[model samples]
Target: MSFLKEISEYKDTIINRLLSDQELCKAVYYADEGFLEKPDIDDLDNLIYENIFPHRFIPDTTETAKTFVTISCTDYRPTGNSFKNGLLNIYMFTHRDLFRTDYGYTRMDFIMTKIEELMNSKRGIGLGELGFGGLNEYVVNEKFQGYVLSYRPVDFNR
Candidate 1:
């Protein structure tokens, strides 16, 4: 398979894993404040689904509050003539107010942990097992704060 196809399939896999977890979905709904207006369960699901992006998050001026995730690849290169290696990055963004609670632990901590559980060591079509790389803080537009989790293919020989 082509690299693009592999990436696309992997993205879909990630989305499916995330959406299938009820606990994670509930946390995401609360973090996004979906309960404030008493939205339907379908609405919550739609909101969560819409927030996830394949490559990048297109900024929207009309959105006053948002939480989202972006899946991207970096350092892509051919290895040993037939294999490919790269890093897959998952970025989670949310408003600063929802980023951390007063007790020092952040609200996103559970979300990130859940994602790690779902993705780490997972294998995708045309790719090797994903190994956890690292996690770090990331800020966007002075209003959003979150974490970026990186993963690398274990063998890159698929």
Candidate 2:
């Protein structure tokens, strides 16, 4: 199969195998990585879940197209016992045809340690829901390269 088709196939396989909420979230989290050492695959799966199925999830397909990933981070610490929420920064590079993706979230909430570690990491793409306030929401200032990623969220509902 072609590259995009293979990813789509993995997506379907993940959706099929992780039929429960908890299982689904965990599967999605790891699948987001989508690459692993062959012999080490089982070990990685075991580290995440108490089973072997996770090892078979990633497709070690070769890449023919150039690609880059966007880095994202949460805006704050977890509050109360509810699901944690945070803002993410997205970047852009000019391509003749740029594409936007939903990133279909896993309903997978991250603990403070996980959140901090992931946010600090230089690689790996994060998957999360679009927070309730929508893009019409507010954004505080922070530095990015030489420019600031400042923006006023637009409320499409308004």
Candidate 3:
């Protein structure tokens, strides 16, 4: 399978896993086109109180009403001289507050851990260890927490 296809499939698997929880059914998103404009405080309030769990800007590409987790390709490059060995980085996005609340923290942790497990265990996808090891933190204007993960697809020989 092509690397892009593998990435897409990997994303679909994650979306399915998250949606298993009824609350998160429509909370996940894929930000392939880039992020939506930052909403004003008024809009933020509307999105939050209106039962909009996941926040999103572009309703056109987003699957659900709100956006909880946004997945995007961070980086893709060769790890070795040959194109056979390469590293793929996928960034998972969510509200920073999720990491503060007890329930949210646990749920977020579960999702992240599950993603790593699924990637490593699924031989077909060829996901290897993260670029470093654990989750790398990134914040977007105090609103979003981006967890950047590094993975190596299995070599063709393997």
Candidate 4:
């Protein structure tokens, strides 16, 4: 497959895995408003699905609150013959207040853990199993405080 196809497929896999987890969905919903009752599962799923971006996060001025993820292939290289390796960066963003709020430790914590559980070591099209590298704090504009989780192919020889 072409490199573009590989990256696209990898991103789709990540988004699908995230949306499939009910607990993660609930955590996202509660992240903004801890006191609000849970909404329907489908609604939560839609909310997450809509927020996930493939290569970029286009901030909407109309949005008063935002929580989202942006998936990007930041680096890639061919190992020789047909083999390849790359680094994938997944950025999880939430409102600064929501991220810092103490709702039994905050929902960003749960979201990050769930993302790691779903994505780490997962295989993708034209790529080896994903090995989580590390996570670092990322500031997305003034309203958002986020983390960037890095992943790379585990076995480059494949």
Candidate 5:
């Protein structure tokens, strides 16, 4: 399962995208928790190809440069009657997993240099050595601390 990648390996890929004219500031939206994924594929490819290839960027991203942005997955719930009635009252948020209620959350921060090195294959878990928990979440090795997140579920809507 080659899906996990190091966040630090995409520095030049990102910095270059940021400087391009394609506008890398646009973010990917996860309506549920209102999370924003920066460096959206469009932001990255624009630097090299001038447009997002195929479509939105996913966990196993392909386009470089655009991969430098942070993609966060968060959990949220209703806050008041308005929220319960679907009144668009986004009043609450937390570090919970959208699907993994017991273990759900995300922090996309990673080193710049690491991101560049990772852009080579777009395969394997973090650093190419880790485990993906059955729940489609990254499982940290007791000894290695690497994030094995290849088990990520497919986002059909994307």
Candidate 6:
């Protein structure tokens, strides 16, 4: 299959799988809000829900039950020959306020940890047939409390 088509399918698999989890659904915004200014922690309760998009923009930000998760499927520059491998970058976004807590672990930590675990676990079940390999790694951003998942589609031939 074409790498582009395979990556899109893999993204669909991820979105569908994550949306199935009730706990994740409550916290996850299912869209990226990179285009807008980050929401103020104080005003997080005032956001509207209609503006969220899969690439950039999540509008709901209610506190205590804030939808702070944005899942974006991004494309990176090909690392080698273009015909064989393709990378997909998935980002998980949350407010920086979620990075620190009385519990010492923080909400972002929990979410990012759980997400990486879930994605890796689902690799052979829900995602395996999509021609995707296991996650390369997940990283936490210093400023945004966002987690990034890097993955590759397997066996794309010219």
lDDT of each: 0.69, 0.25, 0.42, 0.70, 0.25, 0.46
Task: Residues 5-107, candidate 3: write the lDDT tens digits.
Answer: 5556544554444444433322233221221222223322333323322222222322322234444443455555534434444444555434432343433
TM-score of each: 0.78, 0.21, 0.47, 0.81, 0.18, 0.53
lDDT of 6 by residue, 73-150 (tens): 454334457444554555555656544444446555555666665665345322343333444323333334455565
Model 6: worst 10 consecutive residues (lDDT sum): 43-52
* Residue-pair clash count for candidate 6: 2
Model 4, 19-102: lDDT tens per residue?
788767666655555523566476544664466777767567246676777788866877787667778888887777676544
Query: Which regions in candidate 5 have their CA more than 4 angstroms from the true location?
Result: 1-67, 84-158
Query: Candidate 6: deviation at residue 135, Å?
Result: 9.4
The Cα error of candidate 2 at residue 72, in Å, is 1.5
TM-score ranking, high to low: 4, 1, 6, 3, 2, 5
TM-score computed on alpha carbons, candidate 3? 0.47
Q: What is the per-residue lDDT of model 5 for residues 61-157, given as tens digits with 9 covering 90 to 100?
A: 2322222233222222333442211110001111223212111432222212232233323433222422222212232222111121212211111
RMSD of each: 3.6, 17.9, 10.5, 3.1, 19.0, 9.1
lDDT: which is higher, 3 or 6? 6
Q: Pick the TM-score winner.
A: 4
The candidate that wins on lDDT is 4
lDDT of 2 by residue, 33-126 (tens): 2221112232333333322222222222132111111222334334345333344432211111112122332112121112222233222222
Task: Give the range where candidate 3 is weakest over 10 consecutive residues by summed lDDT.
Answer: 30-39
Off by over 4 Å in 6: 1-3, 29-53, 56-83, 100-104, 124-143
